[model samples]
Target chain A: MTETAGTYGTEFFVRWLEAVAEAVEREADRLTELDAAIGDADHGANLRRGFTAVRKALEEEPPTAPGAVLVAAGKQLISTVGGASGPLYGTLLRRAGKALGDDPQVTRERFAGALGEGVEAVSRLGGAAPGDKTMLDALGPGVEGLKVSFSAGRDRAGEGAAGTVPLRARKGRASYLGERSAGHEDPGAASSALLFAALAATARAEAADGTRTDGEGAA
Target chain B: MSAGRDDDGRGGGGMSAGRVGIVLVSHSAGVAAAVAELARGLAGGGDTAPVRPAGGTPGGGLGTSAELIAEAARAVDGGAGVALLVDLGSAVLTVKALLAEGGELPEGARLVDAPFVEGAVAAVVTASAGAGLDEVAAAASEAYTYRKE
Candidate 1:
């Protein structure tokens, strides 16, 4: 397993995005239901549309580099989501892609660092931190845990998303509800958790298929 | 989103070189256009600057679109600058995204932190007077202190 430290390539990213699209499709209703309680009630539908467009764009023009794939997907989401989530998520992916800098393949450690940069960009763009009942709640912890391992990242992201249930919204439209924003998980956090789960799933699939020469050993 | 360019239709000869352009961004297409109209009508300073409305999603729903905001900003940009007044959450974020990307907007485009209607009126009035970007944005921000009481 140590001989096999898996490196991620453009195909891995594309698979991750497709997995995100599928996950968003499967969970859109729940995400939207969560949003209906505290947000605009369109998180599910908006993400569905955005990810669908991303899938289409990726199919029509497959990018050669992992960074290009993420950058293109981010642009698609920004254009199609038609909501605050668009810019926040778009900035995350775009900044991460920029950090990747046309790398055709990256080690897991390098990907984790790039993802950290993406999460930081999101924090700056939304002016929100982990406790703000926003996507950063999930993404911040997820990126941190990714530095340890994929399973650790997924679990931490899920926990961070669930932790938002008790946090009064301090950012985005949910903040408009004031104290009433508590008792609801942030839709953005939920979706972000889904992204991490998809990443984990993609890694698992790649590992099972022996597509990558390196394994998840100690990563 | 809505391709909502209210334009005030006063046939403002061309983009005013010295006057900063104004854009009113809202989640509702009608609301943005109405606000733009009201701001222009209330300004009553004779179409001194272009006031464009960029509102609603591309599907004409009740969400903000970065593409629409970018388009509206470009439409009203007059080489001077563009001052955007956003209504609420996503409107503000969409404009911020465009500005952060530094694309599809004229140089000196700014998001004004002011009340939607009041800020638009003040911004239009000031821009019509051939105010620069700073002056126009300042007038808009000043509306935050406007007291009806």
Candidate 2:
């Protein structure tokens, strides 16, 4: 079938969910490793549980719309996980889901904008600035990077993840570390980068399969 | 990565056909028990999916003993697979050790790092929905990494 515009079908969104789950599973250890340095060292473990729940929910009742999938995932995160990251991260997904609003397919521009909204929600909830050395340190720039890469016809999720270094944490557990958090990358940021990377990878794969249409209507 | 058939033989999302179970491990048995209670509450009158809580045994060793965790893992892996979730620090280490000693993890078996609140909520929700262990595990992990916008 000829790929439509920026919109993705249920299958595509499901793939996105799966990719996210896999990414979290693979990197859970790394996240905990980072958190251990400054915070309680449970970021990895906490996230692993949340995503596992999301995946299970999806399996039971797969949503038809991309937004619904995200919304459901967000709800699962908020209810199943605990700790500061739970609410912060849950709010982000919930916000993204709201922004998506039942759209079955999302264009590159639209998805990027929605993600930006999600990031903004996280910033507001956490009360952290760009260089606060929290997940935002990575996500703020990661979202910006996605915008830029999408616009430039390039994918730079990895680049954004790499940029989280040299920042001081202003909120969350890491914030307590003061200047100590400056040098180390934020665990949240690293994970956020994975999210974007998964998105980019999904889009690219679809595009390669000729399942994605290019240009205006694709939005 | 097969999305195996559900109980009805219908190919839903990636749900497996085998029976599903839960394995909860925490530093304190109280914590694990609390999680189980929450799961039961959320489960309502629906199918009673097996939820094995480890680590909080009454003995003096630790809240959750390594042996208890291994047993829980084994129970979950009997059929479709088991989903493992734990609290912070040593609790996590304890569960990992149990998994290592528990022999091969079922095809769909997995360990989730979800926070106490979110992870429990997610697991309960998934169980109530009749989701398989693998699916529930995926949700727990996703919830952990989610950020609000």
Per-residue accuracy of model 2 over B1-149 as CA lDDT, tens digit each: 12222222233322322456677877677778788888767667345566778745435333345456655655544356667787764455444433432343334556676877578667767855777776787777778786767
Tell me the TM-score of chain B in each candidate.
Answer: 0.87, 0.70
Q: What residue pairs are clashing in model 1?
A: A4-A214, A4-A215, A5-A214, A6-A214
> What is candidate 1's CAPRI-style docking category based on DockQ?
medium
Instruction: Give per-residue CA lDDT, model 1, range A54-100, as digits (tens).
Output: 99999999988888889999888888898888888888888888889
| TM-score of candidate 2 on Cα atoms, chains taken together | 0.56
Relative to the unseen true structure, what is the C-alpha lDDT of residue A58 in candidate 2, on a scale of 0 to 100?
A: 92
Quality of candidate 2 docking, DockQ: 0.03
Writing each residue's lDDT as its tens digit, candidate 2 over A101-218 gives 9776776667668878988877765567776666676666666766665423223445555666777677765777788877677787787777777776766776677633332122
Top lDDT model: 1
lDDT of 1 by residue, B91-142 (tens): 8877887787776566778999999999999999989888888998989999
DockQ of each: 0.64, 0.03
Winner by DockQ: 1
